[model samples]
Target chain A: MSFFKVEHLTMKFGGLMAVSDLSLTAKEGDLIGLIGPNGAGKTTVFNMITGRLLPTEGKIYFRGKDITGTQSHIINAGGIARTFQNIRLFNDLTVLENVMIGYHGRLRSSFWEAIFRLPRYKSEEKKMRSMAGELLAEVQLDNVADEKAGTLAYGQQRKLEIARALATNPRLLLLDEPVAGMNPRETGDMMDFINSIREAYGLAIILIEHDMRFVMGLCEHLIVLDHGVTIATGLPVEIQNNPQVIEAYLGEPEGA
Target chain B: MSERHRREWIYKLCTYGAIVGLFAFFLQVQNQADEYQIRILNVSAVFVTLAVSYNLINGVAGQFSLGPNAFMAVGAYTTALLTLSPAEKELSFIIEPIIWPLSVLHLPFLPSLLIGGAFAALLGFIMAFPVFRVRGDYLAIVTLGFGEVIRVVANNVQSITNGPLGLKGLSEYTNLWWSWGVAVFTVFCVTRLVKSSFGRAMQAIREDEVAAAAMGINVFRHKMLAFVVHAFFAGMAGGLMAHLITTISPTLFSFFLTFNLLVIIVIGGLGSMTGSIIAAIIITHAGEWLRAVEEPMAIGPFNIPGIPGMRMVVFSIMLILVMIFARQGLMGRREFSWKWFCGFLKIGKRRG
Candidate 1:
C-alpha cells in the first residue's frame, strides 16, 4: 500500500463531474506535480485530498487509514495542510500572528495554566512565537512579520501562505498554484524555497504549477488531468510523451 | 510600542490609581456630602459592573448580545424572593410564597445576595445553552428573543414575578460596599479572563471564526462559555440595582436599560476592560451632573430657563461623533501592556 492513495474518486456538482473516477498513489517523500490547463480540476483533487471537499464516490487512505469526509482542521491535524490557488490567508492578522495562529491547534497548554501564568504556558507561547518567526524568516518574510498580511506584495503573500501551512507541522503539504502570478525571477526564487523547505522539513509535497519548466524541474513524478479525468500518470519523461496527455492539452488548443 | 505608547501607559496607570483612590475616599461615610452624594456613588458602582460584564460578551468574546437588562431582572427577582420576610412580603403582596419556603435564607444579607446571584447565573446558563450554535446576527436575534420571552413570563406569571405590578419592598442591603466590591471584582475577573488561553481562543473567534476553528479552538464551546460568564456578572449587577433603589418593577429592567449599557461601553472602548470601566464612571456621574445644568438656572441679577432632555440630545451626538472617529473604542483592540512596550524597546520579552 502507498503512503497516500486515492481510488475511484468521483465528485459531481449537479450533473457536471468536477472529478471523475481519479485514482493515484503517492509514496513517502514523493514530490509530485499535478498539471493541466485551465479548469483541469487540479485544485479539486487537492481539495478532496485535504478533506476540504468530500468525494461523491471514492476512498482516500493516508498512511493506510481511510480518511473520507473528515473536517479540514482534523485532516490538517492529522498531518496534511494545504494552501489555496488564490492564497486564502488571514489577511487582517499580522504575518507572525497568522503563523502563530496556525500553531494554535498544536500548542499544549491548559486554559487554567495560561490564566495562572504557569511557567509552562509562558515558555510554550514564547517558543511558538520564536518558531513562527523562524518559519517566516525561512521564506525571507521576517522584515514584514509585524505588518498585516494584506499589506504584503503579491509574491510575499504567497510565501506567507506557504509558511503558515508549514507552521501546522504537516507530514504532507499541498501547494495549489504556488507561483501563479510571479515574474520569472520570483518564480525561480519560489521554486528554490519550496525545494529547500521540503528537504529541511522532511515532508512530502504535492504541487500545482502551470509553469512547465518549474514543475518538471522539481517534480519526481507527474500526473496529467484534463476535463476532470486523469489521462496519464508516470515518471515525468513518461507523462511528457504520453499521446493521450498530448491530445488532452492539444484538444483544448492547437499543435504540440 | 512607540514613545507615545509608553507615555500613554504611564498615564493609564496614574488614572487607575486615582480612580481607586477616589472610590476609597467615597467609602468613608464622613467624607459624604449628603444622601444624594452616596446615592450617586452606588449608581456608579452598578454601572461599572454592568459595563465590565458587557465587555466580556461584546468585546472579548465577540457576541453581540442585547439582553443585559433581562438578566438583571432575573437577579433582582431571585434576590427579592429569597430574602424578604413573610410578614413583610405579605405587606407588599409581591413575593410572599417564594420566601415563605426559605426561612433559612434569612441567614445574614451577603449570603442571601450570593444565593440570589447563583440562581440568576444558573438561569443565564440555561438560556444561553441552545443559542450558542449560531453566530453573528442570528445569535443576536435569539438572545433578543430570549430577553423578551423572560419579560413576558415575568409579566404573566403572577405567582412568581407579580405580573408587571412587580415585586417590591425588599431589603436595601446595597451601599458603597456590595456595589463597589462587585464592581472591582468584575474588573478583576474580566481582565483575568481576557488574559487567559480561553480568552485568546475567544478573541481568535472574533478575529476569524473559520481560521480559529481550523486551529481547533472549539468555537461554539468558547462562545457559550463567554455567554454564561457574561450572564453571571449581569445577574449580579441586577441584584445590586434592586438593593440600591430599595424597590423593584419590571419597567426598571427593559430593553431601554440594555441600550443605556451599550452606550456606556461604546463611549469607553469595545474590547478594553479599562475603557469600559472608565466609561462607566463617566456615564454614571455625567448623568447626575446633567441634572444641575438641566434644572432651573439663576444667573447673577437675572434668571435663565434650563432645557430638560437637552443632555440626552448632546450625549446622542457625542456617541455619533465617537463612532465616526474612534470606532475601535478608546483603546482599540489592544489591552494596556507594559511588557509589550519593553519588547518594542528591545529590552524585554522578544516580539515577532
Candidate 2:
C-alpha cells in the first residue's frame, strides 16, 4: 500500500482556483519535490495534505487511511508533520521548549497529573526534556537550547523548525522552502542536514523549494506546477528538460 | 546525590519552609492585626488569585478576553445563593421569590465555593465554543459583550439573582487562612501548568496558532483548557470576595472589576506568575493607599477639595509610564526561581 497519497485534490478561494486536481503518491521513504513559480499553489497543496486547509474536492490518505479534512493536529498526530515557509517557532519559548511542544501530541500524562506533578508526568516530562535536548543536539543547536527561539539567527531558526517537526516523530514530513533565505554555504549545510535526518528517521519528505540546484540534488522525483495546475511530473532531470516546465518557470518566449 | 539534584532539594526545602513561615505570620496577623489590616490582607490575597488566573488566558494563552467579571459574578452569586440560609434568601428576594430549588438549597462555604468555581468553568466551556472562534480584538469585544450580558441577565433574572437588589448579609468566611491558602494554591497550580507539556502547547498557540496546530497541538482544546481554568479561579476569587465583603450586587461585577484585573495582570507581566503575584499585592495595597488622593486635603493651611476618581487617573498615568519604560511589564516573562533568588542575594551581599 502507498504510504501517503492525495487524489484529485482541488482548492478554491471564492472566485480563484488556488489549486486544481492535484494528485501525488509517496511510498515509504520517497523524497518528492513540489516545484512551482510564485502563486502556483505549491504551499496550498502542502496546506491541504497537512489539513491546514480543506480541499474543495479531494481526498488524502495516509497509511491507507482516509485523513482528508481532518484537523491539522490530528494529521500531525497520525504521523504527518510540516514546517512553514516562514519559520514559525514559538518565539518566546526556549529552544528546548519549542521542541517539547512537538512531543505534546503523544504525551500520556493527563492534565491533572501534569498539574499535580505526579510520578508519571514527572517521568514523561524528564524524557521529553532529554529527547528535546537530543533533537537540538542532532541539529547542532544544543549550545543555544536555553535561548529564546526568536533570538536565533535566520539559518538556525530554519534548522530549529525542522528539529521541532522531527520531534513529532512523523513518517511523512512536508518542508516548505527549507532553504529560502540562506547563503550557499548555509543552503549546502541545510541540504546535508535534511538528507541525514531523512535517512536517520526513514521519513518520506515532500518539499517546496525555489532553488533549482537544491531541489534537483535532493528530490528523486519532481512535480512542476503553474497557475494552480500540474505541468509535469517525473525524475528531476525529466522535469528540468520539459518544455512546459521551462515555459512555466521562465515564461513563454516573447511570441507564441 | 548529584550537585544539581542536591541544589534542587535545598531549593524545595527553602520554598516549603518559606511557605510555612508565611502561614505562621498570617496566623499572627489574624490574631493581632486590626480589622482593617486583616481585610486589606484578605483583599490582596484575593487579587493575587484573580491576577494569576486571569494571566493564564490573557498573558500566557495570549487571548485577549474581557469577561472575567462575568465569570466572577457567576461564582459570587452561585456561592452566595448556596451558602445563604433559606430565611436570608427569602428576605433578600422581596421583589420576587428566588426559584424553588435554589431558594431552599444551602451548602457550607467550602462546597459552595467549589460549586461556584465549577459553575463558572461550565460557563467558560460554553463560552469557549464561540469565543475561541474569534481571536485578539474580536475576542476582547465578544467577551466584553459577554460580561455586559451577564450583568444584564443578573438584573433581569429577579428570581435567580434577586435582580437589582443583589444578595446581602453574607457571612464573612474569608479569613486570612482561606484567602491566603487559595492564593498559594492558585500560584502553585498555575506555575505547575506553565511548566507542563500542555503549557508549552498553550505557549505555542500563543506564538502562532497555525504552526502550533501543524506541530500537532489541538489549538482549540488548549485554548478551552486555559479559559476554563481561568474562569474557575476567577469564580473562586469572586466567591471569596463576596464572603469577605459580606454583600453583593450585579453592579459589583462590572467592567471596572475586569479593568482592575487587566491592570493587575498588565502591570505583573503578561506571562509571569511571579509577576502577577507581586503586582497583585502591590496594586491591591496601592489602591487602598491611594484613596487619600480622593479625599479632601489641606497642605500648609491651603484647603483643597478632593477630586473623585483622581486615584484612577493616577493609576492610568502609572500604566502609561510603565508601558513607556517597561513595555513587557515588571518581569518580562522571566519567572522567579530559587536559583535567580540566590543569585540576587549573592549580588546584594557582594554590594554590601
Top-DockQ candidate index:
2
Q: What lDDT score is found at residue B111 in candidate 2? A: 99
User: What lDDT is reached at residue B128 by model 1?
Assistant: 74
Candidate 1, number of clashes: 0
lDDT of 2 by residue, B1-352 (tens): 5999999999999999999999999989978999999999999999999999999999999999999999999999999999999998999889988889998899999999999999999999999999989999999999999999999999999999999889999999999999999899999998899888888888899999999999999999999999999999999999999999999999999999999999888888999998999999999899889999999999998998999999999999999999999999998898999999999999999999
Ten contiguous residues minimizing lDDT sum, candidate 2 chain B: B194-203
- lDDT per residue, candidate 2, A148-238, as tens digits? 9999999999999999999999999999999998999989999999999999999999999999999999999999989899889999989
lDDT tens digits by residue: candidate 1, B1-352: 5997788788679658866896778667526568788888888899999998888888877889888887888888777766677666555554434334543344456675676667767876787777776778998888888888888888777766677778677677887878888888777777777765567667767876655655545666677777777777888888888888878877888788888899988878888887888889888888888778787778897787889887888778878988999997776666656556546768534552
- Tens digit per residue, CA lDDT, model 1, A1-256: 6788889999898998888998888877889999987888888888788766888999999987888888767777888887778777766568888788778777687656765668998898888889999888878899999998878999998888888888888888889999898988999999899989998988899999888888888899998888898888888888888888877776644554
Question: By DockQ thresholds, what CAPRI class is model 1?
Answer: acceptable
Q: Which ten residues in a row have the lowest lDDT in candidate 1 chain B?
A: B96-105
lDDT score of residue A74 within candidate 1: 78
Looking only at chain B, model 2 earns a TM-score of 0.98
